[model samples]
Target: MSKLVLSELTLSHFRSHKRATVALDGRPIAIFGPNGAGKTNLLEAVSLLSPGRGMRRAGADDLTRRPEALGWKITAILGSLHQTHELETWAEAGNPRQLRIDGKAAPQVALGRIARILWLVPSMDRLWIEGAEGRRRFLDRATLSFEPTHADAVLSYEKAMRERNRLLKDMVRDPHWYSAIEAQMAEAGATIQRNRQDTIVQLMAAQNAAPTAFPTANLTLTSPDPIPDDLQMALADNRGRDMAAGRTLIGPHRADLDAVFAEKGTLARDCSTGEQKALLISLILANGRALARDFGAPPILLLDEVAAHLDATRRAALYDEIDALGAQAFMSGTGPELFSELDDRAQYIEVTETDRESVVMQRTSL
Candidate 1:
């Protein structure tokens, strides 16, 4: 299969790395360092190669190097499907982010057209135990991978909802003021709901067709209340109630993702910690497998501090699965021993902190 790889990457004034350049051959990268060594920062940089606010949901100014706060830039040699392109993204202090593809200025959504990125962060480990908001975001990311246009739908839905909420907060009683906004929300909400549902179906099929050490999860889309079949009318009907509550109540924004461990027939939230983590890994790997078949190549995976949670056997299984996929996964841990399972199948990077600044360098040997 063809591959999507970042053959080369450069970062300047980005979070912990003041300046660093890494050359690669598209192998999975094993990054090891002490806590706060800026290891996750490296993955966050890679996450920005796609659209969105990176993995941390940090703002542009938040990504700038401190003391200087002189904005940051990332440039990459991206290999997508059968084409190669120069992808660049950056932000100046006090300004929004910008992007360029192959030396031509482009919108952030343009990056989504050519690149597919999937990630698993430590913060996401508690996904099943946490509130529905986090699960929605996780499902949306998976959905976005399958359908890049998912981002536009999410943005449109959110923008329209904000306006509707504003009218509700002001106790607007006129239907004329809300008709247009509700129409936009209903249209975009339908797209969001459809894309998420389709993604869940794809993920379930991906899990069933594959044999892996990780546990499979039966995924479903849910909400606080029944999602209305006629959303526009529902919005109009709920306006009085929403006005009393001072917010838009029932819509895609209130949706949730529910999962069950197929083997044990137990809810994910009630499973043991290890089982929960394994289920997450299962879903992520399933997403990767599905994308490999659907998108022509596996996506670049950012796994932040993933080794810390798995046993030696499970760690080896994870590595083997990633290697078989031919995916360039960027995984991190607190020490090189955590990555012994990867051996020569992966490259190595070591990060350190000096004078409160992160220092990154490629290592020839672990």
Candidate 2:
């Protein structure tokens, strides 16, 4: 079985927490607290364990605890296979962030090989109806879970595209300048497209195979400009028009994800509101299963206000599925009753703001 457990969590000047340490047992964790009690901050800190930004994508300054705070630090003990690994992420007074593994400095991407984190925030409630950016980000997060190197490909592709756009706007007709950049973009673009395609394939397979309460999503990669199999040819074909428009218009950058209710054959946006939320949850679970099969472990999951959106039956089913998968899922909500179905198979924590400081306590053992 694959498992990632948190034995200890320490926070200093993190959000509303001035200083705190919470010991955890081996089980899924459920956090309950009122609004603005800094419940989500705890999850955000855990999400930082993986690559890219945290769940909220807040800036460094935004994470610092309220008045009189300098910076924040989080230390976690990740356990697996009778072994333990210590990880820490911190930002100093008005300084850039830093990550430490076993007391040694490491790159952000390196964290992926050691730990994988995935999340579903309350803001995502509008995912289907909102713009494509959130959905695209959601897809990329799933992409990164299976293939950590997808991060580098994304970075490389975006950098080259930026330079290509600059050249276009400058009216630099010299093929020499644009050629090298376009070549870089083409190489990375092909890799990006392939990774996304492979991830979707894995998700679809998992959705078909999974037996759960959530509804399956028929997922596809959509694009206004068709992504040609031949990268060089595609780039060459779009060069003139791209130069005129001041941007490369025919690459992975313009791609969007299309999702539908597999059973009803209704588009995600057209589905009922409740059905849309179910589809999103189904896709996230499918992403986790796919990663588990491909990487030998499921990514750590963060579900913010998850219980609020899910009915009792679906909530019980989700809990059962997550327990069976042996995934370490951290779920947040307003009350402990939402997690009642977990019974003795989960951990419970209470988050609240008190006496000008934030607190996270292991209130009960599930």
Candidate 3:
């Protein structure tokens, strides 16, 4: 059995899915159907099993089923190692999302400790060509997987930065007003940087330790300018400039992730679309491998429309790698042929759309 798996998932009033239930075994899942059949919606629901706003970064209001707008609920049975966790999350219309674990109320970060989930969506195809925000978000996700408390540090940092920026925008010059906030930012920022650096190190080690069809990527964490040894002092020194710019600058917020296609020694930004996609898959797989050691089980992977981007050989190789790693990955494709390589190694879920609502027709094991 896969070390980590979602044995069951139920979605209600989420996106195009009015109500859908899927019972799964500990194997890679192949979700296939025509476009708009809600395959991705299933993966999105699994993504919410971890921290954050799911893979789409959607708000609670946006997740509510339209016309009804009664909000949504997702419940799952997660198998982590030998332990089974009953997880539930829901939102009431326009209200904030809430989480309950093992039938007890819990914070989102608490979920991080029980489940390590990673994802790759179609919109991320532009990760290299797009702005640094996407890359940073990806790096942070990786970091958060390794350190569940990374979310707390990130929240603290962002909260403090927002306050600092507000002061800057208001042109507040009082040193006292900035002292406490700067200290908070510096402390959290340092933790964030260290956690990210450790994640990159772990990912690289995982890649070199194993061989796969995917190419290696050399990663580096960079900043727009040199980050100072004394972050608090640096913030104080740059206050005048920050006030002029109406925002705080030169911290982890300005940091960017750089990647090179190691085999070709070319920047990821310069690689072909297909090559870029392979690199991403490699990293995600490596992240899973590393987590298997750290978390005592492999991570649950969410790969949306990923098979459509790879050739038959690579697709087979991807399945083989996932099997070798013992990860229960959820993958979506438009047709079953895209995942033919999975054969008896996977469980298939067929979905279809009728009258604007996505329905789970059946799940067949081949």
Candidate 4:
């Protein structure tokens, strides 16, 4: 099978690392450090190699190093499908982020074609109990992993919805004004919905086909109101209600992802905290396995502080699964002992903060 890996990574004036570079050999990376040691920052840099804001969702200004607040930059050597590509993403003085492939300027969406990234972060532990937006974002990320064009569809839908919301806010009553924008929204929203549905199908099939230590989650897409079969007409018909609400009321934007523990038949939100985490891990693993089967390579996984959340046996199982999949997963934790299960199967990196500067030290080999 072909492999996708970041063979080399360099961070300049980004977060706590003024300048840091790491060369990799496609093994799962085990990063451990004390609190505030900037371990997550490294994962954030890897996330930037893909589309959208990094995992922190911080604005350009927020990613710049403090004191100087200079712009931040991340450059990577991406190994995908047996080919190598150089990727560079940076922001200058709080300007919009820029992307380059092989030293030529490129759009952010282009990155998705070359690199597929999937992540499980600490903040996502409460995904089941949180508002629908978080769940929607999570679902969208998984969709984007399977279909890179999903990003373009999401951006287009959001743009059209923003314009429609503005018109509604202005109390525009003209049918022609709403017609074109609603058409755009309908087209993009349909694609978004279809992509999400397809992704859920893939995840379900993956979970059912593979036996894993993690609990299986039955996933479904739902919305507060019935989704119209004809979104354009729905948008036009609901303009009055939307105008009253001052927003686009019925679309994929309002969609929610509902999940249940397949064996227990209990809602994810009602499951114990550990069960919830396990379910999420199950989904993420299933997503990776499905992508591996479809794309010829599994994605680079950013599992931030995941080891600390699981007991030794489960942690070992997670490592074994990742290794068996031949995925280069970057996992972070607060101490080296958290990653003891990985032992010789993964590369170990120790991050430390000293004198207000972060240092990354390679502590183990492949």
Candidate 5:
């Protein structure tokens, strides 16, 4: 089976880099640079290859090169088999972002179908302990990787919920209006919930089958609302509370995924910081393994500052698992020492900033 590889990268008017291009070899890429050296920005550019916001979750306007001076563009050569394909993403001088594959315009969501991507950022370090929104997003990102259509269900569910909220606030008490919106919500919500359950099942199976130092987690969906097996009945039942609260409080939107360290019987949030990080790493590896087996090609992995939180042993283990899966992983760090163990097996890149301009150079061993 052929694998996906990024053969070349070019960026202009994006973040701290004014103009830069680097030819890449087919190996895990290790990028080292100081803070604010635009290390994470490179990862963010890679993330745009998939759907939704990049790693930083910045808006299209924010991504426009600072000083409001110029537009932004990112182009990359993606190789699979013996053929190469081009993907370019750009935002106008002061307009919304757009994407094109092979010079043909396409929807942003279309990217996920062509290239699945999964990532872990430094901000997600306390995901389990924080609000459910972030954890839900994390789960959805994983879900989207496995099932790109999940994006449609999420969009539909959110749209319907928004309308219902507006109706509640406006006191548009028409049962007919409620009927239509609730129907849409129920259909989309059920599908959304099912997708998440399926993704968790796949991850669980993968984790159970894989061997790694990363701690394992047991995941479950928790919500006060009973996700009805029957959509119509669910809508009718929750209508009273919905009207009173002026919000659709029961459905996929309310569901939260709970994770616990299975062996230790520890709540993910209650676990030590290191344990929590380990659990996240375990899940990410499990995700990669699952995708590799299901899709024949593992999804591209983005680990922003992944090495900073782990000890030497765990960091090495992470690399080992990634190698075994044959996935293309882009990991960022502050120096070569952080990736010393992966020296021979992975490609290396050095990032630096001088005179407020960023440059990326590929490193090779003699």
Candidate 6:
């Protein structure tokens, strides 16, 4: 099978790194650094190689290095299925970011076709207990990994919903404006729902087929009320109530993802903190395995501070699974000992901040 790897990466004026570059082999990468040394910043840069606002969802303005605040750029040579593409994503003075593939300007969504990326960050440890928005985003990211076009569907649905909400806020009762916007919302919303459902099925199948230490999670795509079979009709019917509420009430935007520990039958939110993390890891691995089966390669995974949460046994198991799957998983921690088990199996990079500038040094071994 072909492998997906970032053979080379360069960062300039991005976050804490003024200028840094790293060469990679087709193996998982273990990055260790001190607090505030900009380790997660590196992962965030890699996350941008895909789509969306990256792992932090921060605007371009927030990504630029301070003092200089001169904008930032990330360039990479992406290897996928025996093919190579030059990818560049950047922003100028906090403007919206742009993408270039092989020297040609392209929309952000275009990167989705060639680069499949998924991530688990420190903040996501609270995902199960947080509001539905976070869970929905997690599901959508998985869906996007499976179907790149899912980005387009989400964008369409959100755009239409935004317009509809405006009309609601303005108390515009004209049926003409409502008909077109609602129709667009219904079309895109339906696509969004279908993609999410399909991804859940794929994840479930992958979880059942794999034999791993991580616990399995039973997932369901749900909403407060039954989604109308004909979304257009639902929108038309909800118009009165929506205007009163000043928002679009019923659509894919309001959807939620519910998960339970398959073995324990306890809601993920109610699971022990460690159990919750395990469930998330299980789902992420399952998502990767499923993609590898369907796409000839697994998506690049960004796991920030993941090692800190796992016990020695589970940490060793996690490394074994990552190696077995042959995924280019990028992990970060505060010290090399956190990734001791992965010593020779993964590449090591040490990051340090000196004089307020971050430096990335590739080490051959611990």
Overall lDDT per candidate, in order of appearance = 0.93, 0.85, 0.92, 0.92, 0.86, 0.93
* Residue 9 lDDT, candidate 6, scale 0-100: 95
TM-score of each: 0.98, 0.96, 0.98, 0.98, 0.96, 0.98
Candidate 5 lDDT over residue span 1-366, tens digit each = 567678888888888888888787767889898998998888888899888888788887787667755889999998754457799999887688999998999998878667867899999998988898888898998899898889899999899889889988787766888888888888998899899999999999999997788888999988876677886567777677777898877788888989999999999999998999999989998998888787667778899999967999989999988888887889999988999988789988889998788878888841
The TM-score of candidate 4 is 0.98
RMSD of each: 1.0, 1.5, 1.2, 1.2, 1.5, 1.0
Residue-wise C-alpha lDDT for candidate 6, range 1-366, written one tens digit per residue: 788999999999999999999999979999999999999999999999988999999999999998999999999999998899999999999588999999999988888888788899989999999999999999999999999999899999899999999999999998888998899999999999999999999999999998999999999999987788799989998999999999988989999999999898999999999999999999999999999998888889999999866998999999999999999999999989989999799999999999999999999999
Overall local distance difference test of candidate 1: 0.93
Per residue, candidate 2 scores C-alpha lDDT tens digits across 1-366 of: 566677888888988888888787757889998888888888888898888779988777788887865988889998754468899998877887899988899999988887777899988888888887788788888899888999899999999889888988998887888778878988998999999999899999999997878888888899987888887677876778988887888888888999989889999999887888888888888888887777777778899998866789999999998987788889999888899999889888898888977777887664
User: Which window of ten consecutive residues has the lowest lDDT sum in model 2?
Assistant: 357-366
Task: Report clashes for each candidate as comma-separated counts.
Answer: 0, 1, 0, 0, 0, 0
Query: Residue 50 CA error for candidate 5 (Å)?
Result: 0.5
Candidate 6, 187: how far from true, in Å?
Answer: 0.6
TM-score of candidate 1 relative to the true fold: 0.98
lDDT of 4 by residue, 1-366 (tens): 999999899999899999999989999999988989899999999999988997888888889888888899999999999899999999999599999999999988888888889999999999999999999999999999999889899999999899999999999999999899999999999999999999999999999998799999999899999788899999998998999999988999999999999999999999999999999999999999999998889999999989756889999999999998899999999888888887788888899998888999987642
Poorly placed runs, candidate 6 (over 4 Å):
none
lDDT measured at residue 194 in model 5 versus the true structure, 0 to 100: 92
Q: What is the TM-score (0 to 1) of candidate 6? A: 0.98
Top candidate when judged by lDDT against the true structure: 6
Model 4 spans > 4 angstroms off: none
Worst 10 residues of 6 by lDDT: 107-116
Cα deviation at 259, candidate 1, in Å, is 0.6
